[model samples]
Target: MAVLKEKKLGAELRSVLEAAFPGQEARYFLPMSIGNAPEHADEGAALILEGRKTLTSSPLWDYLDGTIPFVGALGVLLDGAGQPRGVVETTCVEIMPFRAVTEDMVRAYGEGERTLEWWQSVIGNLYRTSAIRHGATFTEDTPLIWEWFRVVRRL
Candidate 1:
């Protein structure tokens, strides 16, 4: 198995995604492999361009694993030199929305609650402004994970 040496995984991923789609908004979702995770299905991260957080799901906590599920999103902006113009937006989502506090999971993370770290992790990743429509699909404007890795490995 190959190890990920890239310091900024999110930044690197954003560039490749943007290159695949010039002047267009692109989105991606990849599984996050957390080392030393409990016995359960590994969750994934949903990456997308900056300022776009319309695609997201509810907090999904796996009772089997004590570790929290993480979802990440990103946006890549480039200039004439092909360098990073700017990062428009970024977000993260957690599966388990109501497991942080025993006394009041909802109260702790809900609109009005304790407002702890876990709550931020769960709510921050979500896109509250918009919601996923019925029967929607990704446009696949950029190369898939495998394809992008193949080229990068050759470099």
Candidate 2:
């Protein structure tokens, strides 16, 4: 996969957002595929660009600590190479336990046949890995932040 410096990618994203939303306050430009491998980052960005993926889940603690992402936010999706791929606007946010994640929400995620079983298998692994890395515990009761977004512009 192609790679660029994060600073360069951020600058490019800023320019695109500025031109697209002139005179508006700048919005956050975020890299995609947190807690996953580089290839998954590429896949996630592609899914967003194709408009197949609209919802993403993360550990609720991340949001509470202001690490990244929030409701009603705008972000530029970045591929594995750290290239800006598109812009997205968050439309909804929900905080719930992992067990509470609905099949409908997983379907909206639009990954791997969009099945609940697939979501469980994939996200369960991701959460487990992230938990180990962060010294946290992963369980069905683990808090999650589910965010729904819409692609507003493709670059």
Candidate 3:
């Protein structure tokens, strides 16, 4: 229950995140919250709050800390109090076949038409199911990771 305020610079956002999780590291940056506007893109970053390998025999062999690699992350900017304030997120992960399904799906997206449909229909369905039931491992509340996102250099 924190208030994630929008600032004029990436440094503001970075400072907020770094303060919240001192030891965590910001890894990647991407465009976010693009409301169908091809040119409107915002800077986004992710930090692995905590990570550990899942010791389960399911399709997800390891939990990479924070949202699963394929699943779109649930992002919330934290406030000084370490509470979620601002939020940014996508409905689903962009990558597929994930670890459970065949890795070929990863290549299919760019390979051919059949590959795309197979990835969208068959493989996507499988992954959605796996996520819903979470057949792999790890108990409830032990979410892969707590993620955050923000738009930077935006007017």
Candidate 4:
């Protein structure tokens, strides 16, 4: 038997957005959650809900060429249990090397020790491991896509 996953989130992409912003339209949206694990996902999503985390970063190499998120991009934030929790709109996007990630940005991540040192050691390791897992190489100078978003609505 096939295992079922992520049942009855009770909202589709369009419905979720519409509920949040009546008459608003988005050309596309990417369903997203914060972490690779259930605990981390819950923690990160909570931060977003609390208005603590407005910034997030991803390896530039993670996106297909020309597919990096642009300003005004819509995303649905999900909790660890795979429940849709909120909608976010990208307000800004910037590129920076991993080592150059600023203190403010890490604070906006609002997780862990919430420091640059913690990010360099902990979040950095996560990024490095992901690169390796994907058969890609990463370095301190690896570019990261830093996105600043606003919580558009809580679902």
- What's the lDDT for all of these models? 0.27, 0.69, 0.30, 0.73
User: Measured by TM-score, how close is model 2 to the native structure?
Assistant: 0.82
**What TM-score number comes out for model 4?**
0.85
Q: What is the lDDT of residue 6 in candidate 3?
A: 26
RMSD of each: 16.7, 4.1, 15.3, 5.4
Q: Tens digits of per-residue lDDT for model 3 on 1-155?
A: 01112222266555544454455434312212211121211111112111111110113332433224222332333323333334333233332223343334224222114343464455345435555664553333222222222222111
Ranking by lDDT: 4, 2, 3, 1
Native-vs-model 4 lDDT? 0.73
Each prediction's total of clashing residue pairs, residues at least 3 apart in sequence or on different chains, is 9, 0, 5, 0
| CA deviation > 4 Å runs, candidate 4 | 1-11, 22-24
Please list the residue runs of candidate 2 whose C-alpha ends up more than 4 Å from where it truly belongs after superposition: 1-10, 26-29, 61-64
For 11-82, candidate 2 gives per-residue lDDT tens digits of: 666777777666654455454543345686788788778888888887754443455556656777777676
TM-score per candidate, chains pooled:
0.19, 0.82, 0.23, 0.85
Query: Taking the tens digit of each residue's C-alpha lDDT, what string does model 1 give over 35-153?
Result: 11221111111111221122222321111133322232333333323333333222334333222333343232223243455434444333121113312222212111110111111
Sort by TM-score, best first: what order?
4, 2, 3, 1
Stretch of 10 with least lDDT, candidate 1: 146-155
- What would the per-residue lDDT of candidate 4 be over residues 1-155, giving only the tens digit for each residue? 00011222335766777667666564335666777877777887888889988888888556654476679877778887877888888899899888887788788877778788988898888888888987888899888888888887788
Candidate 4 lDDT for residue 132 = 93
* Alpha carbon deviation, residue 133, candidate 3 (Å): 38
